[model samples]
Target chain A: MALSASTLKVGDTYEEQVVEDLKRTQLVQYAGASGDYNPVHTDEVFVTKVAGYPTVFAHGMLSMGMTGKMLTNYVGDGRLTQYGVRFTRQVWPGDSLTAKATVKAIRQEEGGHIVDLDVSTVNQDGVEVVSGYASARVDP
Target chain B: MMLEIDPKAKQGVQLGPVTVTAEDIQSFAEAMGDLNPLYTDVEAARAAGYPDVIAPPMFCMRMRGGRMLPEVPLPSGFMSLNAGQEIEFHDEIIAGQTYTITSRVADVYEKTGRSGPMEIIVRESTFTDAEGRTIVTIRERQIVRSPEKKI
Candidate 1:
């Protein structure tokens, strides 16, 4: 069902805590699924030996997808007109994350009602891993 | 012999014609650990007014299902990371539909920040549905730097 605009205030918020902390194979699975085979994401030995990193880190899109989950949980899939994020920090294994989207504005646009949101994801350290915004059409 | 990429590798390239399937949508949602019914159950979607179950907003990122070339090639022994992303959703994507996406290296430059010398490549991708309707536009910034180049 379309979101009930009458009930969502400008400051209303929706949040989700990821069920899994960081998985070891997520990057490789994502690499296979997304086809972003950048070795920095999948090949740990390449990173540790050549590029020099402790181990494989989470893909920014993985975290963004998690944040997208948070939004979809609240607004449902296919509801967003625009959603974006800037990678702020790298996410390592064992780091827990929380994604949040808070309603920022509500207005009318041609064909539907538009709702703007301020979005963010933070890690266990409370450091922002990614931050951005989204605008969606909430059919009334 | 490593990853010394040619900067031209990513110029005005066509990325995909990946067909969206129920399995594709499901795996992505599972990877994201998001079981939102709108992306999982067709009946649930029908109950919610959609003709079929749809993909999440971020699903487009994985729509590039093949080897996508980079606009600016990086030297081996260097690592790259996503700096940021900007996306505009123009339309909804439903399962069993196919979407073609084209991408180009929009910009390549170097910046010395709190970190150090870093090469930044900006890439733009546009996703269009089978009927030629625009679905989404994505802009990505990738930061490449030598592992030793730190503050």
Candidate 2:
């Protein structure tokens, strides 16, 4: 159900564990689906021997995409109007993530109720992986 | 060493007029581990008022590849990583609609963080439907860093 602005408060929040033990194969799946064939995301040899990273890492969009499931679940389908994020930290294989959304405002726009949210996703150790905001339509 | 990006690469380069298919939406949603019915069930999506199964909000990101610019030559041992993204959704991406994507290198700069100096590339892409209506806009930042040398 969509959130009801009449009953929603600015501090209301929703959270979810988006991913657990993120797998490298999942990154390959994302690369195929997203059409982003960047070697750094999947080719372990290239990423480590050539690019010099410790190992293959998760795509930032993957983190955002998983986090978005949390947002859409909270706001309801077809309700989101705006969503954006910054990759604050790298997400690695075996990392688990929790996404959170705190209501920042409940107001009306263009004759409809809207909810603004502060969006954040943190790794198992509590380090933020992605940080951003989102706005969605709500019921009055 | 500094990287050199071709001036022409900064201009908007068109990518596709690919049609969105139910399979595409389903695969993408499945890949992200999002089991939202609206993304996979046509009946559920229609009940929600969309003409067909709708893609998730970040679906536009798939079109972000097929590089808009030629690769910049980085230091021999440096790596480029996605730093962030800002997306604005004006409409839901419904299956059966054809969309075109145009991406450009918006900017390039440098900054120093705890890891030392890094180069940032900002790329912007716009997704428009067959009717030329803007569906979404995505601005992405990529960071280039070289590994530290051990003496």
Candidate 3:
């Protein structure tokens, strides 16, 4: 089935809840999978003693991954055409992250509907840790 | 130690002949605890008008193990940190499609911060579908910090 781009509109908003413990485990798993054993992510003691952080921090990619999840869920599969982001701050293990996406604009090109989106992940204190935009094609 | 690199010095490099499947997309969605029907339910996806179950936007980020960073000519004792990324999508991905990635070292530069001097390197990856259609282009920047600083 092809998605109709006409159904999506500007001002559409999507939100997701992020659990802290799940974030911690995901961070550890990412470390193991990516071989990024940075102490700031996996070692609380090292983070405290060496880096002076309050606790173990989540990997920046992990946060970005969470944002990607938000977009896929909102737009539906196969519709996502492009995604990117910038890491703004560190996410600690216990921090609650919220992912949000808002429709910014819609354009038609090459026989397809293109939707531009503003996406972001904000921590519990409301600081955006990751920010970027995504574009996708849908049936119109 | 002061390190010098030409910000304009860069070359294209290839990363994958990876096969993307619905299972991989599902796993990634599940791993992230996202239940968006667009990523899971085929009926919903169809109703939404996608040709098939599509992957998450950042799905390519998980395509690992094809290349080793150390194999590239990078400075020693410096840890790499993902700084930013920009991606442009060209086509929708279907399950069971094979892809070949061509990547290149795009640039290298230096920036001084309160912590010290940081080296920033950019890598660009182009994903081509099995039929040779270009699917996406990803530009990623990574910061390599001198190991002398513990942080």
Measured by DockQ, the strongest candidate is 2
lDDT per model vs. reference: 0.78, 0.86, 0.71
lDDT of 3 by residue, B1-151 (tens): 4445433334454556887777677776666566567667777777867766766665666653313232344567555567778877777655667888777666667787557788777778778998899888878877777656633
Which parts of model 1 are misplaced by more than 4 Å?
Answer: B1-11, B46-52, B66-70
DockQ of 2: 0.67
TM-score for each predicted model, relative to the true structure: 0.87, 0.92, 0.78
Q: Write the per-residue lDDT of candidate 1 for residues A1-140, one digit (tens) a residue.
A: 56766777999988878645788777677777676787767788986887667877788888898888787677755678888898888788778999899999998888678889999899988899889999887867
Which residue pairs show collisions in model 1?
A: none
Question: Residue A108 in model 3: shift from native, Å?
Answer: 2.7
- Please give the lDDT score for candidate 2: 0.86
Predicted structure with the largest TM-score when compared to the true one: 2
Fraction of true contacts retained by every candidate, in order, equals 0.73, 0.80, 0.46
Calculate candidate 1's fnat. Answer: 0.73
Model 2 over residues B1-151: C-alpha lDDT tens digits?
5568778768777877988999999999998999899999999989988889999987888755634243567777666777778888888899998899888788889888667788888888888999999999888887887756300
lDDT of 3 by residue, A1-140 (tens): 44356777788888886555456677776665444566678887866775566787776666887787777667765667778898888787667888898889889988778888998889888999899888877767
